[model samples]
Structures are given as C-alpha cells and as structure tokens.
Target: ETVIYRIYYYINRSGTGHLTLRELKRGNLIDAMLHCDEEEDINKVLRYFSYEHFYVIYCKFWELDTDHDFLIDKENLIRYGNHALTYRIVDRIFSQVPRKFTSKVEGNMGYEDFVYFILAEEDKSSEPSLEYWFKCIDLDGNGVLTRNEMQFFYEEQLHRMECMAQEPVLFEDILCQMIDMIKPQLVKTDYFTCLTIEISCLQDESYIMLRDLKGSKLSGSVFNILFNLNKFMAFETRDPFLIRQERENPTLTEWDRFAHREYIRLSMEDDVEDASNGSAEVWDESLEAPF
Candidate 1:
C-alpha cells in the first residue's frame, strides 16, 4: 500500500495515541514489512527502520522545526508508520523464539531500546568500510595513520595554491570555513537538479523562472547573514528595491523599455480602448520604467 493510505487511513483509523503491539496489528504491519527469509534480513529491516526514524527526527529538528510540529506533518506521519510497522514485524519474529532458548529471548523492549540497538548495529557495520579507506591512506603499509604521513599528504595535495592562503589553525575556524564552502555547493546542486527535473516534466517555463528568481532572492538573504555574521539577525532589513530590480531588470533593455512604454500609452490612449480591454492583463508599469 502507498504511504499516504497507510498514514491517512490505516494508522489514523487505528486511533492509537502511541504505537503498541495491538496498534501495530491493527495497522496491518505485516503487509508493510518486507519479506525476509533469514534472521539477518529481519534484523536488517528492524535496524534500518529504527535508524530511519531517528534520522528523520534529527533532520526535522535540525532543518525543519525545533518545536516538533514536523512530527505532525504528512511526510513524518508516513515515516513514523513505516518504522512502527517494521518494529511490529521484528517483535513478531522474536515472539517465535522457543521457551527452551532462554539466552536468545529479547524481553519486553521499548522504542528507545530498539533505537539504540539500531544505532549500535549501524556503527558495527560501518567499521569494515572505513578500513579500506584507512588502508589506502596508510601509504607505507603501516597498520595505522600517522601524524607525519597525514601532514605530508595535506601539504602536498590539500594546500591552497596561493601563498597567502594559510591553513585555519583553529578547529572552530576550520569547521566554519568548511560549512561556508559546503552549504552553497549543496544549495546550487539541489537547485540545478530541481530545475532540470521540472524542465524535463514540461512544466511552465515562465513559472519555473519565477520560482528560481524567488529561490535566488532567498539564497541572497542567506548569503547576507553569512557575510554579516557579527550583526543581529533581522528579517525586515532586506532591501525590497534591490530585490525588485534583480527580478525585473534582467529582461528589460533600453529599446524594449521604450517600445513597451509606447505600446502601453497607445493602449491607454482613450476610455473606449480601456473599456473594450477590461479583462486584458495590463503591462503599463513595466513599460514606464526609465531603463
């Protein structure tokens, strides 16, 4: 079933204020859980969903809302349902454990325990992948990365070409510089990808352009904050005139402005013309610009 139906209908209809085994059963958790023929597959799905819930909450806190309203959003509701469904499946699989297998039995575990278990599992799985990168950077087949090796690599490859470009000596300064470089790159890449996708779908080009202009203005506002970090963050200080100029001035040239003004003047020459074109979209203000 689609996430929308699961969130909007099944879970909501279950009327459970919080997720429980009973609620999970009523939510039709079995259908949502992916088919797993092995014990490892069951564990993987359980850990994956638990991690997903934690990550979703983390992202919502960091990027969307700190007050927890993100939990109420439709997207988050779907995510919560998915995780809850996975948890139910894992619980069911554990329920099948024989009474004789006392050592393998997991006692009544709450959501928090499940979350922590997922995190531990992820940390264990990540170690082997990092080992490969460690080996590649070890250079002399040394078992570990050394200070001298790291310094040599940094100076030879990572150093700036400009002699005036000094390395950031402080950890906080280095972190801030890294954020400055990374944030804009992420934004630009996202913006370009979104534009490409929208264009590919044959969306209205003019509307897309307007949306892009709005996004550019928002980005400029964000840039102003980074540029003037020492100043107080204020919403009302943005220059409206500069924003308007940026939006409209790109398409206007001296000749176009002149001709546009003439066309508007001709259209509004008399009351008869204005009455006849009452429903028409007017472009008088755009035409009257001084260029």
Candidate 2:
C-alpha cells in the first residue's frame, strides 16, 4: 500500500487529484519504457532505467553503510557528501517530517529511503525535491516556511562557517537575497516597503510559499544556502564549466550530473584501492622465504 501510494503521488504531479496520461508522457516516460523493453541493456535508457543511476545510488549507500549493514543510522547519513547537510536538516530527515520511513527499523534508514533522500538532495529544482525540502523546512508543519523556521536551519550553517574560519554570511543578508531571488508574496507588505523596512520587521511580514520556490530556477540554491554548505559554496563560486554543461545538455537532470560525477569518483577510488592491494601482495611475496 505504501509503495502504491508513493507511485500514485509521484505520477500525479499535477496534484489535481487525477493522473492524466499527458502527465505520464510528460518526460517521455512511456517512450523510454518502450525503448527499455526493446533493448537488452536497460542502462541505455538514461532517463529512468539507467544502471549508472542505480549504481550511483547503491554506491552512495555502500559508502555510508560502514558496517556493511543494509541500513544507515544518523551518523552514517551525516557523513554523506562529506557532511554537506546541516544537523538541523538531518534531524528533520530522521524525524521523518519530510516523508515517513518505510523501514520498520527504529532509527535506521533503508536503501529505499536513502534513494529518496539522495535524489531530493541532489535535485532540489525538481517538483518532488522542492516539496521534500519545503516539508523539512516547514518545521511547524504549517505548510508555509516562516522566517523563524528558515533561520532555524540556517543557524547551524552560520555556526559551521564560523567554526571553519570562513567569513560567515549573516542571516539578514541571506534573507534579503532569498527575498530578491524568490520574490515571495509578503504577508502584510508590498515590494516597495521591503526596501525601507528593517530586516527584523520584514521577517514578520515575509514568508516563503511553495509556489514561490517552485517558480524559481534557484530554488535548489535556497535550500543549499540554508543547510548544505558544500553545495551552497559551489553555487556561489558559479563554475563556468558546469554552467556550460547545463546549457549544452539541458535534458540531463541534476541527479544525472551528480550520479555521473560520483560514479567516476567511486570507480577511481576502487582502482586505487586495487592497485594498493596488488603492490602490498607483491611486497609480501618478495619478503617470503623459500620453503
């Protein structure tokens, strides 16, 4: 029942309480499925059935599952992306505020849960990712992301920056930037007054609506700025090569890029480990006495 509902929810992207054939065909899913059936190699269907993507997801889980267990606890997940996510966000995830855990285990997240998390973490611009984060940030479950709620997450990020000896960006400055970028409808104010009012006052009058975030291309950056330090920094640096890649291959999702990069990194690490083991074996053989 859980799996069925999840599939239905995702397929019904329109949220009109109805799943249309048009929506199903939106991403060429049907065509991809047809090709996937025809081809002996499912990996060739990069959109959904790509083996590369599954390999990336599984590799991420394997790396985090240090005990070789099939599940990961909070500590394990914290190590993800070199601890890119803030503790507050991790807490929210463990709390299952964004989505309920399918795993029957008390505190550990299963592979399926990790897949949901990694996809959402990597691709915040997508509808499901945006929704995932919004629920996590909406700490009170009020459906709206209030200033206090946003700051609750950003506080740790600020502390992390200070601890790292980096010039910390104040929450006020970040709020201003978010307002400018998202331009969410102010509760009791207009855009003209926003410039004149103090940051503290603006907090009471401003809130981020889901639509506001969904409308912006930089929605992912908003979440990154709040909790994921590594990604947020990368966003600020604005790598021209990445920008060029996005322009060149607009069809590729953020998940695709992230998976590709991680796969290469993991493969290289495996090669290096193999080479090290081979050298160690050779050294041991040379040291062996004839008997």
| Candidate that would win on lDDT | 2
**What is the number of backbone collisions in each predicted candidate, taken in the order shown?**
0, 0
How far does residue 193 in candidate 2 sit from its true spot (Å)?
24
Return model 1's CA RMSD, one decimal.
27.4
Q: Which regions of candidate 1 deviate over 4 angstroms?
A: 1-125, 156-167, 170-291
Give the clashing residue pairs of candidate 2, or none: none
> For every model shown, what is its TM-score relative to the native structure?
0.18, 0.81
Looking at model 1, residue 263 earns an lDDT score of: 40
Clashes of 2: 0
Error of 2 at 179 (Å): 1.1
Q: How does candidate 2 fare on TM-score?
A: 0.81
Question: What do the candidate models score in CA lDDT, each in turn?
Answer: 0.31, 0.78
What shift in Å separates residue 63 of candidate 1 from its native position after superposition? 26
What is the Å distance of residue 157 in model 1 from its true position?
6.9
